[model samples]
Target: MGFFPDLPITTERLTLRPFTRGDVDAVLDYRGREDVALYLFDAPLSREECALAVQQRILQTSWSEEGDKIVLAAVLSESDTLIGELSLIWRSEDARQGEIGWIFHPDHHGRGYATEAAGALFDLGFQGADLHRIFARCDARNGSSWRLMERLGMRREAHFREHALFKGGWDEEFVYAVLRREWRNGG
Candidate 1:
């Protein structure tokens, strides 16, 4: 993979940027909610935990080698509100593949924020980072996430049944992906 670009990728309505110390409160406000933590791997975090998480995210702003993960805070341009978070994980150096994921506050749902932010991450992964392929995975039950993946022009590549046990039950997973060529051709 190539070098990661600088911070703060601006969309028409959102800013994709590094997490800051000041964002800790907002992070806890959203991430601490039970509804928001339902599908997440980790349980709802407390203020102290969120502060540490934000600190770690701040440190990740400096792009490192392949396999390093970059986490960006999705903020509303007008209000500068931290609405969500997006991540790109360099999956493989030789294969030039990466994985992307996101989490948004429930209050901001039904809007196009996740779609817009994720699309920008895809563009950065393929065009800026020079990755050959980028993919995303979500719990099959999470209709909104998979739908957003489809809206971003990624094709459904795989579906694993009862993939894992989560939240005291079985969970399926769907994999969606797009290749550099496919992205370039506007697929």
Candidate 2:
């Protein structure tokens, strides 16, 4: 059941592991949706090139001095199909603080896959990575993301008005962060 026998993290319903070149079509298929891409990223990525870029990023993590980035493919635990992606990008200067992001296929959106994957990753961050804080940023307009953050027990720390530039204009963001102490305290 270990799709990533070499990697140090896995979950009952997911596998968080290094990306591969073969993931091009699936990654592109998810990234291709305008609704999924607009609020999440600045631009749409070209399928093959972007997949290669993602692969290169994971490869570079092997040599990273502080292990600031982890890009994981969220595969189904049962079938091992790559359903989506989850990531933790640490800010090296912040000790153990990191930010997380996730995306699933539109068909899988409301089925609690995000919550399951994130909860598993949060534990992986706290216990496996020894991270102190892991957070997620969601657009204020994205009610689904906001609700997901709450369901995951992440408290809203800040709401930035026009926090990011998207498609030549400004957009607001809700920043949610959870600390090690809070997680330990059952927050």
Candidate 3:
């Protein structure tokens, strides 16, 4: 399938590429932090778990089927530092839609790295993958995530109150989406 690229996608200051074994330490460094895992569905990972997660992501970098998920490591071009990650989950082949998500090291926050990486993922989903629509969701309390989604020109489509049990309690969720036509029209 033409769903994935073997080469890394380079942005002005970042490079979006597949995860490698060498990236485990960086992954654990960030993903192991409580702040980073606060909004995530899973708890903070240990060193071994982070290694396995990296291996899983590396495996997902190649998309041989319609439902394959693509996960990219966002590295700072200047330093080649793995600062964060961006992902596009193939939601429906029939609907031509996908879902996106992201995470970054707390140390890399406030630098616009997440937004830049996410925008690249959006372009890949809509233009590269020829998807009809792309959407993202985050806990309602994740102001930074939702704000970045907005900055990427995604419209807030829904706010599900107490959508599901998260972290042992009910939490609201915000959904943001953008259509291919909208993206092409500079949405």
Question: Which number leads on TM-score?
Answer: 3
lDDT of 3 by residue, 70-101 (tens): 99999999999999898898888888888999
**Which residue pairs collide in model 3, if any?**
none
Residue 178 in candidate 1, Cα distance off native in Å: 0.7
Alpha carbon lDDT of each predicted model: 0.89, 0.74, 0.88
Residue pairs in steric clash, candidate 2? Answer: none
Summed backbone clashes in each candidate are 0, 0, 0
Ranking by lDDT: 1, 3, 2
**Ten contiguous residues with the weakest lDDT in model 2:** 1-10
- After aligning candidate 1 to the native by TM-score, how far in Å is the CA of 5 from where it should be? 1.4
Ranking by TM-score: 3, 1, 2
Q: What tens-digit string does per-residue lDDT give for candidate 1 at 1-187? A: 3465777899999999999999999899889999888888989999999999999998775447776888999999999899989999988888989999999988999989999899899888877888899999998989989999988889999999997899999989999999998984843
